[model samples]
Target: MFSYRHAFHAGNHADVLKHTILVHVLDYFNRKDAPYWVIDTHAGAGIYDLRSEWATKRGEFADGLDRLLAAQAMPDAIERYLQAVQHFNPDGVANFYPGSPWLALQAMRGRDRLRLFEMHPTEIEVLRDNLKREAAGTQRQVAVYQADGFNGLKSQLPPAPRRGIVLIDPSYEDKRDYRHTVQALSEGLKRFATGCFIVWYPLVQRREVADLQRALTRLATPWLHATLSVSKPAATGLGLHGSGMFVVNPPWTLHDALATTLPWLKATLAQDDRANFTLARHGD
Candidate 1:
């Protein structure tokens, strides 16, 4: 259960899709004066070194974030997302990657709070150390826990301000993660009906992948779903071909932003002619 490590795939295509929408949601939340909490259910190590042994072993970012940074005339949303990533690489070089926890810190204001949970013991320690070094002042605004995010989430719902964004992005290494994702979201809604929820799932050939998509869409909530398929599944079906993001109670402007961004992104990340994208809302 603790085998999966995000450092291996930190800035890959999935991260592109997940973090871009995350940045948009954070930006939307900031538009209002009411303070809101950002709860990351599966927070990783907070930051990753692209040159590290784990990251260099895979070099997945070469086809993901590196492509975007090398491209020109990015869509508005994608551009903003890149800018956020650039915030971590202040020397104007993309040598490091910031995970959801770090990205949330970039957008959160003084009144806003961030709650993170990670089940992996090693990752929890790294997360805390990263915060200590890079976010010294965030001690009061951020909380990190080494516990199961899926089960621990209940205690943090319906935050003191009654406004929050719950991000459920388990690694799904365990087959049960798919089921747990659906269950967590269902329970989360009951506690914070109006809170924004962002879920990220891989586009694999597994039945659970399809089942998770179906379950999320059928929920009784206004939502938006977006996917980016960079290639057709391999013959052995051993690797991720793409990924999707489902946003419940999404911002009014989110659908349009993604509609304009996905097309260009599909072309940018295409591994073959099978590369494509999807953007749909509840009524669609």
Candidate 2:
């Protein structure tokens, strides 16, 4: 069952990194005249209310986007991400947060198409409603499905749009999720080798993260991995200390973009000594 709900962690440090890179990728895709497709596996409610009980319960944004917003002389990548979020919050008072699907919609053009899959019924309803409320009148095309994202991805592969991005942002609530990500990504690459893939993972214990990286590296496809750790090593066993993103067939500009933005993020959001950032490419 799909028990993962993004409401509790919207706008956290991980979202900051994932969405920043997502915006850049979408922007790059838009640069071309040919139409492109965006498929969001594990799509959550398109928008989130920071003041809502779920969000306010942890107030995660306070440690993430909030800090990034307060930082001075922001990098261009971060500036673009903030601009997108600002689009949702016209008054500039951070009240709402846009998940990947909504963020992708904001950057989509008339020729672009969006395919979103959310297994959670309530989240699926909210996702549809939010899209209707926020995307009305836009010429961009969208298709949402209330089904398993893993299965949804396989069904939609090699979309009418031969060119596009496939985003995999599973909740990772289940240990099996890690294995599922690798399996799904391996299959996706086989079907759409040219499509860009972005996989987001939380950085908790060293062993888990290392195993994930090892599995990703084993994929018989070229990929790039980037990570931004914002907290010190937890005291033995604790909560999420940081997060990372693995990009398969990443845009050439993404490397430079993250290089410029990650340091700023580390300095602005790091809560302890283990905070740092790393950029690497595996498989040419």
Q: Pick the candidate with the highest TM-score.
A: 1
lDDT of 1: 0.94
lDDT of 1 by residue, 1-284 (tens): 78999999999999999999999999999999999999999999999999999999999999999999999789999999999999999999999999999999999999999999998999999999999999999999999888899999999988999989999999988989999999999999999999999999999889999999999989978999999999999999779999999999999989999989999989999999999999889942
The global C-alpha lDDT for each of the candidates, from Candidate 1 onward, is 0.94, 0.87
- Which candidate ranks first by lDDT, i.e. highest? 1
Clashing pairs in model 1, backbone N/Cα/C closer than 3 A: none
Candidate 2 residue 253 Cα shift, in angstroms, is 0.6
- What is the TM-score of candidate 2? 0.95
lDDT (tens digit, per residue) of candidate 2 on 70-153 = 877899999999999999999979899999888988898888888998888899999888888887965349988888788789
